[model samples]
Target: MRRDKIAVLVPEMEGKIRILLFWLVVMSAPAFSQQAPKIVSSADTASIRIGEQIRWTVAVEVDSAAQVIFPEGQTFSPLETVEAFMTDTTRKNDRLLLQKTYALTQFDSGGYILPTQRIEIDGKGFFTDSILVMVATVPVDTVNQKMYDIKPMMEVQASRWGWLKWVALGLLAVLLAGGAYYWFFLRKKPLSEEEAEALLPPYERAMKELKRLEQSRYLIQDEFKQYYTELTSIVRGYLEEEVHISALESTTGQLLEKIELLRDAGKLDLEDNTLRQFQNILETADLVKFAKSKPELRKAEEDRNKVEEIVQKTKEAIPEPTEEELLQQEEYRMAVAEQQRKRKIRFALGAAAGLLVVALVSAIGYFGFQTVKDYLIGNPSKNLLEGEWVSSSYGYPPVILETPEVLYRKEIELPPEAMGTIQDLDAFAYDDHRANLSIAAVSTVFTKTDEAPDYEGAVDQILAGFERNGARNIITKQEEFTTVSGIPGTKVFGRGNFKIPDSDEFLKGKYAILLFGGNGFMQQVVISWEEDDLYAEEIVDRILNTIEVKTVI
Candidate 1:
C-alpha cells in the first residue's frame, strides 16, 4: 500500500516539474534573444585625397528576426550614405542580413573616425565599434609655372543705336508739323455777338415760359392738374434746351431716373430732395389723371406753388461750365479770372479755420480717450462689476449688460425670456486685429437655489443648474490651458446654431462661446455669433488663447 501511494505521488511530482521547466524556458527565450546585435564596419584605416569619393559598408547580424532602430543624432563622417538596404531570414538555411552602403567625399584634408551606429532588436539596444578614415592632402607641383600675374579680360560696353535717335527726332518733327497745320488751318473762326445772341433764343424762350408760369395764379384757382402739367413741361423744355434731353415727353419716374444719372455724372446741380419733390408732384398728377382720383383744394394749391418754385430754383442752380467747356467759350475767360481771385481768399481762410478746429479736436479726443482707458485699466474690479459684462462675436451685434445683480443673482436670462434677444453680436477692436467681444449669457428669473441643495455647493457642481435649453448643435473643443485675469483656467470652445424669440430670420444664426475657469471666479468669458458658421469657434479659440490680462489693477 505504501509503494503504491509513493508511485502515484512521484508521477504527479514529475508532471509538476515538467510544467515549471516549460515555463522557465519560455521566459528565458525572450531574455536570451534580447542580447545586443553584432555589427562590423569595413575599412579600419584608409587614405583618400580631398574631393575624392570613398565607399564604406556596415554589416549587422542578429540572433533572431528583430526590428533595428538607429541611434539618435548619429551620422556618417565625411561620408554620406547614399543607399542602405536591409535583409532578414528566419529559415535554418539563411540568416538575417542588414547591409548599409555610404558614399563620402571631403573638401578639407583631415582624418575622421566613423562613429558606430546604434541597433535595437526586440527592445535590446547596442552600439557598433567606430572605424577610422584618413583624408590626405592634395599634391602640389612647382615646375613649369610663370611668376607674373595675367591681366583679366575686359567686358565691352554696348553702343547706343544712332538710328533709334534719328527715329525719335523724326517723330517729334512730325508731331510739330501736325500741330502747326492744325493751328493754321483748323482754327475755329471767331463768332460775332449777333450769332451768339441768336444761339441763346431756345434757352431764353424756355426761361421766359418758366418765369410766366411762376407768376401765374392757376393753382390758386383750383386747376392743380393743369398747373402741374404746364410747370413740369416748362422745366422739361428748359432741360431739353440746356442738356439736350426730351424731358417733357418722358414719364415723371423716367425723367427722375435720367436726372439722377445726370446728377451722379456731375452734369446737373439739382438737389436730391428737390428732384424727389418733382417726382412726388408728377406721381400725384398721374394718380389724378390715370386713376381718376381727386385731390384736396389745399394740396392742389401746394402742387402749383411747388411747380413754379422748382422751375425758378433749378434755373438759379444751373451748373457752371466745366474747365474744358470754359476754354471753348469767350465769356468763361472773364468768369475764370474772377473765380481765381475769390478762390485764393476762400482757400486761405478755410484752411486756417479747418487746421485750428482739427488740432483742437484731435488733442481733446486723444486726451479724453486716453484718460478713460487709463481709468478703466486702473479699476478693473469696479469696471467689471459695475455693469453686467457682455460681449459678442462676428455675425452679431452689441449685447448690453444692464446690471451686476442680474448675473450674481443666479438667474438665467435665456432667449425666450429676455427682451430683445441678440444674434451675431460681433465687437471688433482695431488695435488687437481680432474680435474683442464673443460669448454672451443673459440672466432670467430662474435661480440655482430653486432646485439645488445650497448656493455654494451648487457653484462647486460641474455643468449643473445651467441649462442648454435652447442651444442647438453644440460642439465643444478643448484648447490649451491658460489663465484669465490671474485665474487658472482651461479654454473650451463651443459653436452651434442659435435662434432668438420674437425676431426675424436675421436673429437665427450660428454662435460660438468660450468658457474659461477652474473652480473660483471666472476672469473672462467671450461669446460671438454670426449669421453664417464661418469658423467662428476657431476665431473664438484664437482670441481666448491670446487673451492675457494686460493689467489686473
Candidate 2:
C-alpha cells in the first residue's frame, strides 16, 4: 500500500513541477514585434554652392497602427526652403513609412547649423540629430585668367518730365475754358416756351397727343389704316410717357405681361377688364393693318371710340401726384440737366475715370473672378442654369423642390434600422440613375424624434450605404451646410463612379451631391449627374433653394 501511494504522489509531484517549468519559460520569453519605430534625417549633399538647392529629406518608420505626428512649419532661417513636398506615406506589411522632402537654398556663403526636427509617435517624442551645412561660393580660375578694373560709371541724362507738365497745363486750361462756357452759356440758358410745354403733366400730355392725332385728318380720308395707326401710337406713347412703361415697343401680349408685372409690384393699379379692352383694341388694329381684314364702318368707328374710352379711363385712373412727389420729379430732372452740364465741363477727367473703371471691371471679369472662384468654390453643377423650372413637394415632411422638370415619385425599400426610427419615407427622383445627364432626388421622412436629428452622422451612414449599392469608387467630402429655410444640416459632395441603370457600364465622370436636415421629421436631397454638367448644377442649386425642413410634433 505505501509503495502504491508513494508512486501516485511522485507522479503528481512530477506533473506539478512540469507545469511550473512551463510557466517560468513563458514568463521569461522575449516579446516579438513586426516593426520597430524609427526616424531618419539626411541631405543629398552636405556642402552646396551659394544659391544652389540642397535636397533635404526626413523619413519616419512606424507601425501601421501607430500615430505619428511629423514636424510642421519648421523654419531654417539662414538656409531658406525653395520647395517643400507634402509628406508621402507608404506601407510594407505592418510597418508604415512617411517621408518628407524639401529643397533648401542659402544666398549667403557660409556654414550654418541645421535645426533638429521633432517627431511624435504614439505619445512618445523623438528628435533628429542637428547637422552643419557648408554653403560656399563657386571658385574662380584666377591663375589662368586676367582681371580687369571696373569701368567708370557713365552719366545718363535724366528723362525729361517736361512733357507731363505741359500735358497737365493743357488739361487745366481746357477744363477752365469748358467751365467758363458752361457757366456763361449752358447753365445760364432759361427754359424756352416750347421746352416748358414739353414738361406738361401726364394727363395733359395724353390730351395733347389725342388732339394732335385727331387733327391729322386721317379718319375722314378713309386712311383708316393711318387713322388707327396714329390712334394706337398716341395711346401707347401716352402709356409709355405717363405710366412709365415701354408700351410703344410692347406687343399686345407683352403689354398684358408688363401690366401684370406692374400690378404685382404695386407700381400700377389697372383692372383686368381695362387690360382686356386694351388687348382687344391692339389686336383689332393689328388685324386691320396686317391681316387685310375689312371691318364694317360702324365696327371701325366703334373701335376708335373704344380707344378714346380707354384713354379717358386711364386719365381718370391717374392719381394726382403729391406735391412732394411732383417737386422731387422736377428737381430730379433739373439735377440731371445740371449733371449733364457738369460732365461736359469735366469731360476729360470723366472720360479718364470712366476708362479706368472699365479697365478695372474688365480685369476683374477676366482675372479677379477666376482667382476668387478658385478659393470661393461651390457645387460644380453650375452650368445648367436656365429660365424654366418646375417646383413640387414630396414625402412626409413635404420636401419642396424646384428642378428642371417635375420629379417622379420613386419607391425605395427601407433598411431595418431606418424602418425602426422612420415611420414613413417618400422619395422623388428625376432620372433612372443611368445616363443621368442631370438626375435629382428629394426625400422626406417622418421619424420618431422630437430632438434635432444627427444630420452629420445620418449623412455619413447614408453615404456609406449609398456607396455599397451600385456605387463604386465612392469618394465623399462633408461640410456643415444650411438649408434655404435656415435648417442646419450637412453638405456632402464628391465625384464617384456612378453605375448606370439596367446595365454594367460604369461612368467615372459624375458628381454626387447630398444634403440632409432633420428635427422630428427628416429631409434629404440628392443629386447625382454627369460631371461638368453646368446645367445640372444649376438645377441642383434650384432644387436646393427650394429645400424646406419641417418638424411635425
Candidate 3:
C-alpha cells in the first residue's frame, strides 16, 4: 500500500516539473536569439565569361564586444583569389556589421559550388549557404569571320652603338702601343765609355784627357794651334770642376787672378810654383789660338805634360772635406734622387690619366654623350628595349601585342553598380616602379546592352583614374587612330606630373591610351613612363605598332 502511494505522488511531481521547464525555455528564446550572430554570403554575379572576375562578399552582424573570425586562406577552391580587400565595418546601435570582399576568377569554363563558409562568433561557429556559379567561354564565330593573310616581316635597322666597340678597341690599342714605345725606346739607357770617363774625379779625368791628347795626331801632324786649344780646354774644365770657378768663361788673366784671390783667402792651399806653371800654359794657349801664334809641336807636348802636373799638384793641395760638409753633400744627393723618383711617378700617372681621357673622348665622339653615359652607368630602359619580348593576346575582344615581359593577369574590382552593367572585366598589367614605367591592357563586355561604350567618356574615366593615382597637371590631346588591320580607334595622349607615394617629389611623365569599342565590348591599351627615357619611348612605339584587336563582322 505504501509503495503504490509513493509511485502516484512521483508521477504528479514529474508532470509539474516538465511544465516548469517548458515555460522556462519559452521565456529564454528571445534572449538567446538576440545574442546569436547573423551571417550572410553573396557574389556580384552567378555567371561570368572565362578570365573574368567575380566579387565575393561575406557579412556578419554581431554584438560590438563579441569577437568574430572569418574563414581564411584559399578556402574557395576551384576558384582563385586574385585580391582580398579590407573588411568594411559599420555600427548599428549595439551591434557591428562586418563585410569582407574578395576578387575571384577562373581561367576555364565550368560550373562550381562556392562551399559554405564558417563564421566564428564569441567562440561559437555558424555557417552560410552554398552558392552556384557558371563560367562560359568567349564565343568566336569562325564560320562567318573573314580571314587575312599573315603580314610580311619588315627589316629592323641595327642600333647606332654597333661601331662604338670598334672605336673603344682602337683607343685601347693606341694606348698600349704608346706605352710600349715609351718603355723600350725613349727611356734612359746605360752610359757609354766616354760618358763613364766623364763621371771620374777631376784630377783623374784631366790626366786621362792629357794622355788621350798625346795619342792624337794633332801634334805629330804639326797642328800646333788645334793642339794648344784642345789642351787648354781640358785644363780649364778640370779647374772649373775642382776649384768651383768659372774658368772656361774667364780670360786667362781673370782665371789666374781668381786663383790668386783664392790662395790669399786661404781657401786654396796651392804652391806658388804650381800656380806659376798653370799660368804660363794658359797664356801660351790663349796666344796660339786668338793671336794666330803657332808654337812648336815639341812646345805643345811640354805644355800638355805641364797641364797634367798642375792638375795633380792642385788635387794634392786641396783640403779634405769636413764631416759636416760631407753630410750636407750626401743630403743634397739624396734630395736630388728623391725629386727624380717623384718626377718619374708623376709622369707615369699623367700618362695613364691622359690615356683614359682619350679613350672616353673617342667613345663619346662616336656614340654620343648620352649613349656613352647610359652604357657606362647601365640603363634599365635600354636593357628592356633590347631584350627579348613576349607576344600575346589578352581579353574578350582580344588585344594582340608584344611586351618586354609577359603581362600579369590582375583581378578587376568594381562597385555593385558597375558590376550590374559590366558582365566581364579582364585586366592585365606590368609595372616597373624603379623605372617609373607601366603598361596595361583592359577589356570589358557589357551585359546585353543596346548602347556601345562611349569613347569620350572612357577617355575621361582613364584620365580621372590617373589623377586618383597621384597624377596632377594633366595635359591631354586626342586623335583618330586606325590599326594595320583597318580597325579604327581613338588615341588620347599627354603629359602629367606624377607625385611619388609618401613624398613631395613629383616626376614628369607621358602617357598614351588607345580605346576601341564595338557592339557591347571595349578594349584599351595604356602606356606610361618617365618623359626623359628615350628607350622607353621607343618601346612604347613598338608596342603600339603591334597592337591589334579582333573585330566582329
Candidate 4:
C-alpha cells in the first residue's frame, strides 16, 4: 500500500514542478523585452498604382547610448527608390526611437513583396517584419476615347513684326548711344584762357597784350622788324576797336591826318603832345617795316613807353559813350554769344549722328546683318535657346527634362464621360504664339485597371487637340524614340498649316510630339514652331536629348 502511494505522489510532484517553471518564465518576460531592442516596419499604403509613391518606414527603439544603422543605397529590391528621408528620433525614459523612411515606386504592374529590412543596434543586426504591396496598372478605354499617332512638325512663315522689332530696337539703341555721347563728350565746356581774353573789353585786352609782349624775347633775339610790326598792330587794333577808326589799313600820314580830323571835330579829345607822340611812333614802325631800318634796342624801348603814355592820355581825354551806344554794344555781345551756342549745338548733333553710323557699320561688319537684326529686335527662339536653362522632373513617373524657362502648371478640364476614366492628370506648358513656338508636357493617371493604356490612340487625340488650338493640314511621321535613361516612346514629326487668329490666312508650321505610356501611366511632350527657324530647331533637339523618364521594372 505504501509503495503504491509513493508512486502516485511522485507523478503529481512532477506536474507541480512543471507548473513552477512556467510561472518563472512568465515573470522573466518583461526583463527579456527590456534587454533587447524593438524593431517595427510599416508602409503608408498596401496598394498603389504603378508610378505612384509608397512611403516605407522602419522604426527601432534602443538604449540612448547605442549606435543604430539603417539600410542604404538601392537596397529595396523589386521597387525603385525615389528618395531616402532623414531618420527621425524620439527619446523616452533613457531610450531612443529612430525611424527612417524611403520613397519607393514601381513602373510595371504587379504584386510585390517588401522584404524584411535589416537594422543594427550596438553592433548587432535586427530585422523588421516583411510587408506585401500591390502595384496596379492604370487603365484606358480605347472603345470610347479617340486616339491618334504623333504628328509631324509644321512650317511657319516669318512675321513682319520680326523685322519690325529689330528696327525699333536699333533705333532705341542709337538714341541711347547718342545721348550718352552728348552727355560725356559734346556738352558745353568751360571757356579756355584765350577765349576768355578775347571776350574782355578793348582797353583791358590791349593792356594784357602789352604785358605779354614785355615778357617775350623778341628784343633780346634782335627780331626788330617782327617786334615793330607786332607792336604797331597792337596799338592800331586798340585804336580801331576803342575809338571806332580804321587805323590798321591806313598809312602813317593817313592815320595822322585822321587823328587831326577827329581831334578838330571833337570825336576824340586828345592833347597835342599825345598826338605828337602817337605820330612819331607810327612813323618809326613804317620805317622799320618798309625801309628795313634797324633802330637801337634802347630807342625801341623808349618808343614803346611813349606809345603806352599816348594811349593812356587819349583814353582819358575821350568822352563817355551815350546810353544808346552802350545798349547797342550789349546787344551785339549777346548776339555773338547766341551764335556760338547755336554753332555748338549743330556740332554736337552732327558728331552724334556720325558716331551712330560708325557703330552700326562696325556691328554689321562683325556679325551678320541678319544676326544683328534678330538680336536687336528680339528673336523669341534665339532668346529661348541662349537664356539660362532649368532641369527638373514632372508627372507621376517623373519625366526629367531641361527647358529655357520654368513651365507653369496648366489646368486640364476633362469631359463628364472621361472623368470616370482618368483619375488624375497634370500638365505644364510655355506658349508664345507670336514667336510661333509652343511647348507642353502632360502626364495622366487612369482609374480603371481592366485595360492597358492605348498609346497610339492618345497620340491621335493630342494631334486633334492641336487642331482645336488652330492647327490644320497636319502631316505626321511616326517613329520609336528612347530617352537618356532608356525609356522608349513614340515620336511624331511633320509640317502643318495653322490658322492665324482673326484672319482668313493660315501659316505653315512644324511640330514634334513624344509619347510614353506604360500600364496606367502616360507622359507626353509636344513642341511646335515656325518652319526654317534654326534657333527653334536647335532648341527642340536639345530639349529632346535631355529627356529622361524614371521607371521601375
Candidate 5:
C-alpha cells in the first residue's frame, strides 16, 4: 500500500512543476516581444509673438509592465516656460498614454530651434524631435503719429521698508554695542558693607574706626607690628578727618615738618612736647615696618599708651563747630555732592553723543553721504542721479554712453530677411529682466541697400521691428536728437502694451529708440521699462545727455 501511494504522489508533484515552468515561459516571452516605448511631441502652434504664450504638449506611451516617467521643468531654453500642467493619464489598448503640456514664451523676436528633449521610459532615455518656433514682434502704427522721446526714468519710490530694514539693523547694532559696553565697562558691581558705609559726621566716623580697631586681637596675639600699625592709622585718620591734615599720606619725617609748619601757620595748636612725643611713636613704628627692627615689649606698650593720649589731647585742642558753622558745612557738602552728580551725568551724555556722531560719520564714509540722506529723506532717485557713472562702447559703431551700471554684451543673430542689407550685427543689453527694465543697442553694417538711411524710413523700420517683438498700440513722438558729443540722430518715444513672451497677456511699458547713421550702416539704441515707473524718465534724460554715438559705414 505504501509503494502504491508513493507512485501516485511522484506524478502529482511532476505535473505541478511542469505547470509552473509553462507560466514562466509565457511571462518571459512577452518581455522579448514587447516594442520600445513610443513618444510623440506636439505643439498647438509653431509660431508666437514675442511676449506671447504658446502651448507645447508631449505624449508618452508605455506598456502596462513599463513605468512612464515624464520630464518636469522648463526644458525649453531661449523660450521660457511660464506654466506647466500635470500629466494627463489614459489607457488605449494595452499601452498607457501619459501627456504633459507647457506654456512657453519668448521676449525676443527671432526664429529659435528647440533642441531635442529627452524622455525616459523604464530607465531608458528617448529624445523627441527638434522643433522650430518663430517669434514675431508686437505691431505698431508709425505712419500717422509723431514719435516721442523716451520718457524720463520713472521716479521709483524707494520702499521705506528697505530703509526701515537698514535703520532697524543700525539700531540693533547700536543696542548690541551699548549693551556690551555697559556689561564690560560702565555697569558697576554692587558695593560691599565696608564700601557702602553709612553717612556719618567726620569726627564720629574716625571715632568708630578707632573703637573697632581697639576691639581687634592684635594686642593680645602679641602682634606688635599690626597693633602699632592700627594705632597709628587711627591717629592719622582722626587728624585728616577732624583737623584737616594730610597726615594719612605723610611720611614720619614729612609729618614732623608739616606739624611745625601748621603750628607756625596757626592751623594747629598742639604743645611742642606733644608734637615731639607723636613724632617719636611714628618713627618707632616706621622702623618696625621698613627696617624689620624689633622693639622691646615695654617700649611698644608705651607707644600704644601714647597714641591714646595724643588722640584725646588733639581732639580737645580742635575747636568744636558752632551751630551756624555746622549748618554751613552741611550746605557746602551737599553742593559738592550735587556738582559731582551733575558732572557724571554730563560725562555720560557726552559719551553717548560721541558714539552717535561716530556712527553717523561711519555710515556716511562707508555707504556715501547721499545714501544716508536718501534714507533720512526717503528719496529713491538720488543714488542713480548722483551715483558713479560708467562709460563704454557697445555694439558695432559703438553707442558710447554712461550708465549707473556697465552694459553687458549680448550676442544676437539676424535672420536673412531682417538683415536685408545689414551685416556685422552687434548687440549689448543692460536688462536684468527680473526688474522689468531693458536697455539694448543694435548696430549693423548695411551691405545691400544704397538708399541713404532716411530719417522717417529709419524710424518706421525701428517701430516695425518693435512691433514684431510684441509691442502693440504704439503712441510715438519723434524729434531730432543730438548726443552728448553732438552725434545727430532721430529719437522716437512711445508707450505700448508689450505682449508677455510666449503668452497672450500684455504689460504696458515705455520705450525710447534712437536711430542714426546714413553712409552704409545704421545704429539703434532702445531703452524700455514699465510704464508705471515715473522715475525712469530722469534716467532716460540723464542717459541721453551723456550718450556719445559714433556711426561707421
Candidate 6:
C-alpha cells in the first residue's frame, strides 16, 4: 500500500512543476516581443496652393491598441482644416491602424514642411514623417465703382445772457465793504520804534551787570558760597534775557535740575560734567552761605576763582549764537562754496564715464547679435541622422530623439545590479562636415525596493555633463538642431572637432557615433569625434537612414 501511494505522489508533483514553468515562459515572451509603434505620414499628394485646402493623413500602425495624440495649435490658412477624422475601425487582422486627417490652407504663397506628429501605442511612442505644403496667392478683381457728390451738414447757434447779474453784483459790493471794516477794526497795530527801544533797556542792562559780576574775584577769596551764588545768578540772568525764562530767581540746585530735565527733552547740549561742576560749586557755596561753615582759606579762594570761570563758561556754552556773530559768518560761506564746486566736478565725471560704457556695450552687443544671425541663416547644419535604418537587437524601451541637435543625452532606468557595472557609453555619426554625436550615462543606482525613485535628477546630471564637455561646439555647422525622441532625448550638433579632454590619442579622423540603451526601461545615444578616413561615408549613411522623429502631441 505504501509503495502505491508514493508512485501516485510523484506524478502529481511533476505535473505542478510543469505548470509553473509554462506560466513563466508565457510572461517573458511578451517582454521580448514588445516594440515601439510605427509612425508614418500618408498624404494624398505633397503640394497644395495657398487659399486652397489640402488633406493630409497620418497613419500609425501597432501590434496592439494605441492612443494617437495630434499636435497642438493645428491651423491651415493659407491652410485651414475644414474637417478632421480619427477612426480606429481601420484596424484589420492582428495590426492596429490609427489615422487622423487635417485640412490645411495658407493665404500667402510659400512652401513649408509640417512638424512631426507624435503617436502612442501600447504605452510606446513614435514620430511620423514631416509633410511639405505649398501655398499660392489668390487673384484680385479689376472692376472699379463710380463716385458721387453730396450736401454738407448744418451747424447750430448759441443764445446771449441778461440782467439779474447786475443785481447780484450790487449785493457783492455791499458785503465786501462790511468785511473790510471788520478786519481793520479787529487787527492790532505794530509797536513803534520808540516803544521797542524802551523795552530793550532792561535786558541790555541786566546782561552788562551779569558780566561785571562774573569779573569779580569774590570766590577766589575763600568766599565759596558767595562766588557760587553770583555765578548762578549771572547764568540765570543770561537765560532770562536770551530765552525769556526766570532762571535767576531759582536756587542753584533747582536750576541745575531744571537744566537736566531740558537736556532729557533734547533742549540742552551741555556735557554732564558742566552741570555737575555747577552743582558741586553751588552746594559747597550753600553750606558756606547758610550754615556759616568756613572752608579752608586756600580752598575757598580756589572755589571763588572757579565761580568766575563758571559764569563766563556757561554764558559761552549757550546753544544760540549772537546776532553780531551771525553777521561775521564768512568762513562757513567759503566752505560751502568749495563743497559745491567739488560736487559738480564729481557729477560731471560720473556722467561722462557712464555714457562711454553705454556706447562701448552697444557696439559689442550689435556685433555679437549680427554674428549669431549670420551663422543661423547662412550656414545652417543638416541633421546627421535623417533617413531609415534597422537595429540588430531591440532594447526594452526604444531610444527616442527629442531635438534635431547633434549631441544626444538620455537617461536610462535599470536594475541595481545592471546599473552598477555600466559607467558610460558613446555613439557617433560620420558625415562629410565632420558632424559628430556622443551621450554619456550618469544615472544613480538604488537597491531598496520599497518605493520608486525620481529619475529626473539622473537625467539632468547627464545633460549637465554633456554641456560641461563642450559638446555644443563639437558640431560647428549651424544646420545641427536639437530633437527629442518619443521617449526623452536631447540632441545638439554643429561643426568643428572636439578633443576628448586629457586624451593623447585624438578622435580626429572623421564622423563619430554614440548610441546607448539598457534592457531596463531607459536608454540614450550620442555620436561624436568621427574618424575622417575609416568608415566615414558608411557611418553617415547608416545614421541618416535609421533616424526617425517621434511626436507626443
Number of the top TM-score candidate = 4
Instruction: Estimate, for each residue in 194-228, the C-alpha lDDT of model 6 and write its tens digit.
Output: 66644564446445555565566764565566665
lDDT digits (tens) for residues 350-385 of candidate 1: 665786578657766878854444343543223333
TM-score of 4: 0.53
- In candidate 4, what are the lDDT values of residues 1-553, reduced to their tens digit? 9999999999999999999999999999978766578888889999987557899998888888899999987788887676799999999888999999998876567899988777978788888887788998654332322333223333545447646777897899788878766775577669999999998988888888877877788899998888889889889998898888899999888888888998898889887878888888888888988999889999888887887777677788778889998999999989998997787677777877997789878999999888888866868889888766777777665666888777888998899988988988888998876677788888887886444666656767877888997887676655668888566777777788987767778888888888876656678888888888889889889999998764321
lDDT of each: 0.51, 0.68, 0.82, 0.80, 0.74, 0.50
- Candidate 2 stretches with Cα past 4 Å from truth are 1-387, 415-418, 432-447, 510-513, 551-553
Model 1 scores a TM of 0.28
TM match of model 5 to true structure: 0.36
Arranged by lDDT, best first? 3, 4, 5, 2, 1, 6
CA deviation > 4 Å runs, candidate 5 = 1-21, 24-38, 61-116, 129-139, 142-235, 240-553
List model 2 lDDT by residue over 340-389, tens digit each: 76776587566657865786677678788654453236323332243345
| Model 1 CA lDDT for position 220 | 70
C-alpha RMSD between model 6 and the true structure: 28.9
What local lDDT does model 1 show for residue 168?
Answer: 84
> Whole-model lDDT for model 1 versus the true structure?
0.51
Worst 10 residues of 4 by lDDT: 141-150
Q: Which prediction has more favorable lDDT, 1 or 5? A: 5
Q: RMSD for each model, in Å, please? A: 33.7, 35.1, 20.6, 20.3, 16.0, 28.9
